[model samples]
Target: MQRVRTAPRHIAFETRPAGKPLDAEWTQITTREFADQVSAFAKGLIASGVRAGDTVMIMAPTQYLWAVVDHAALFAGAVVVPVYDTASPAQLQAIIADARPVLAFTGTAVHGERLAQAATASGTEAPQLRLLDPDPAIPNDASLAGLAELGTTVTDAQLEERRLAATLDDVATIVYTSGTTGDPKGALITHRNLVGQVLNTAAAYSEVVQETGNTVLFLPLTHVLGRALQLICIANGMRVAHLSDPKEVVQSLAILRPTFLVVVPRVLEKIEDAAANSAREKKVLPLWRAAHRAAVAWGVHLEAMDRDPGARAPLGLRLRHALFDRVFYGKLRAVMGGRIDYLLSGAATLRPELARFFRGIGVPVIEGYGLTETTAPLTGGRPGSLVAGSVGTPLPGNAVRIADSGEVLAKGVGVFAGYRNPVHTEQAFVDGYFRTGDLGSLAPDGTLTLRGRLKHVIVTSTGRTVSPESWEQTVEQHPLVAHAALVGTDRPYLTALVVIDTEAATAWFRDRGDAPARALTEDGLVVCADGRLTEEISAAIHRANAAVSPSERVQAWEAVVIGEDRASEFVTPTMKLKRQALLDEAASITDGLYR
Candidate 1:
């Protein structure tokens, strides 16, 4: 808040006014103006009887207003509880029953109505509802603007006092897990936890602050990584743009031309696909493939030299890499607004091949690892000190170690306090370190390579224990596969449920002029009406199986194409497949495979 007051010209977010061309000049709000808005919103909460420690629910999409309300709630000395906008009614009811927030901010009319219905169904009074973006057409509900109007009644002195009253140990947020196994448990995050994230991120990636002029954040603010970046930007007084709709990302990137980005692997994969498709369309597939190979080679050489500064790239490879930079890499850079220096990837493990490809193109992607319980990232790759396959060293004051059982345990200032359910909280910690439940090994150099979730390990009937993550990683690398989940739990052999990348698969078929209009449905089968599509999937499975050990190989598999019927069949919002959910959904398919 003080930083905002100091840097008045620092652009916070770009606002595209209604009825204007997207390419038109964006309305810029400085830190000073944004601070005032936050202060006003904070005052409104206080005027509405919200007090210190009061739980305020922010159930909305990623937008500037979401950040405003989030900061406002915190400034009002309230503990925030973020609810995913896509959460089911029962999930909403469960959250409402648990936290019972004094106030709730909804993204749209549909979300507001869902909350009201969920509250009524749960037999609990609904929190004071305010629409983040109220439609004038439907003026029945309260608006965020109205809430801000209420804030004008409170004086600045009172607001300042309340903001200053918060301490480091105070509960800042209760972020719920994706709940793949069972009910979602709220992880208690503190002001100290958040502060640690900001300080550590800045220290680790200072180049992101110094050289990168601005950043664009599109990830859901409900997620800790998004929230962490928000705080990092504010702390460093850097310019930022908060993107609301994911569809507008490309346009916004072209318009804002941000220098840095925080994203998931899915975003990069889409960009890579778009670039590859463009090359194929232009009949320059061979040239593009050559350039890609050159880039990966250059990236590998650079990483080798980075590890051992005395090392150097071979003359032939270096010459080819330099040639491609001028011919191919330049065009790829233009796709990302032509100024992106770094792409920080998290939430899901990034494919090293993709990371190398991006780096080969001159846009370095640094991967990180963490969960909601550990705030954002306990360990992340540093900007200048790049590691291709590793989630870099632990943050400044954090410690990451592999247990005898191979689970990754972390002790850090960024670690969450506990779960909202006391018993779960008690179980979450073991010997002072937070049990991440993720399996990984830390190198002597402090780089970490994640294996897979402990609970998601598949134990075959033959007594072979396989971590499906490695196999899934290989399968997803196939151009046709959007998602892959391995299943064998106590079965004879490993089987998989694959989701076809409709666009990529369609293009692949059309390119070959074989059943160009072939389509896949949500039906649980690998063979589409066009057997060629099924053959393509089978070939991909063969590639994946060949990469793993004989015992860990995917022996039998089926494609479960996602559609309206199977809208969130197995994947979480972050695109991580839910092992248990996938198993339950594909029970019949797996049984048939065994028979």
Candidate 2:
């Protein structure tokens, strides 16, 4: 509202039409235009009998209208529930039953049908359905245009009556957790929660936030961090755009030439992989490899100097870095639109080496940490304080304390009100601090370095404890090693169930005019029997093993190839590995290793 009043004509968003070419001109949506859309939609929602505290479901991709409906629903004194476009039927049914929205909105006819089916499957009354993007063929319920027609019956006074009834403490959204371990629980994010994050981020990164540079958001809007970052962008007067499909992100980054990006570790992995593949195809693989090494070296040098004031980068290292900056780093930056200064990563732990690699190439990857209960961001990397392995220092008002049980605890303005379920809420907090379930240690400088999840800590037969995440992340740095899960609970030695990335492995062989040897495991899954592939994987494991004790190192491992469906069962949509699920279901794969 303040933006509309102050700078009504300012461009708030830019979007390219679907099916448009990459070079096509983007359509601009201004602040006043967006604000008006919100007001009219809120009136329509009110006219359609939506009341204060009613849950309004918006199931769709990240786009302009998602922003409109989200704001409109909240403005009408209703709570908004964002559902990811890729949600499965089972997942849909579970959320629909729990949220019990009074009105549901979908961007496509297919999603509308899915919602209707899920509502039926859950045995819940179907909410009044509405289409976000109008389609003449879709039957049932009002479209956005049709909603405007209904708004004629609603008066300005009536809309204001419900809107004014909202309070800061009221639940704005019930964001469901990714549910890697168990059922998804709704974390109660209040209006205050969102505002608090925005304020703190703006304070911490004033120049980074307030700059007039544009950014493209590709993460799912259903993600709490995605939604919160959008708000922070608006608060800081940055022009924003959306790309619903993450696969198209590289092109969007080049097209938008964004000043910064917010993404998870997987996205960075993809970006690096894409660059490496392009280099391989162009026959510049060796040069690219050298550039990568130089960049990483520079990053390590920078971090050492930052930590120790008396330390300085050697002249030889600095000169070589400068050469790589011109010869290779510039082109790498061009792929990222040539203007990105910051790469804000969150949602999962980022590998330390990847952070160093990017930071060395003039793009500092600022890893941050938070959960749905923190409303997305509680800590973020600050300039001059970035530590490669640490997520960052706590934000302006948010602070974390380590519990005796190795859990990260927090209490702050951005802390969520509580969980939606009373039973879960009772177990969620201790002495006013929200239990973060993650285990971490804080650097002397206040930056936080996450070890792994508390529940994932491995206890071996000899009573030796191991943190499998660091090992898994390091081994996964190999493009061929898609996923790694360390196993050795109550066993003599640690073994692993490593999932081979068949696509990448096959491509590598094909590019080299060779083929991978193949065989079937006892459990019937395909295994790449090529010695080269095995050697490559063994080399990666060796690197990871070097960082661990003899007992914690993976002595033997089994390789199995998995497709998307099988992989989905073991990982959340965000690519977070479900350790227990993998160990339980794939127990047979590694059984032969122990014998």
Q: Compute each candidate's TM-score over C-alphas.
A: 0.95, 0.94
- The sequence of per-residue lDDT tens digits that candidate 1 reaches over residues 526-573 is 334346766766777888888888888876777666554444445666
lDDT scores in order: 0.82, 0.83
Residue 246 deviation, candidate 1, in Å?
Answer: 2.6
For model 2, residues 287-400, the per-residue Cα lDDT tens digits are: 888888888999998788776877878888788888888877888899899988788999998888899999999899888999989998888788777888788878877889
As a TM-score, model 2 comes out at 0.94
lDDT at residue 308 of model 1 (Cα atoms): 85
Stretches of candidate 2 exceeding 4 Å from the true structure = 282-284, 304-312, 514-532
How far is 302's C-alpha from truth in model 2 (Å)? 3.0
Residue 474 CA error for candidate 2 (Å)?
1.5
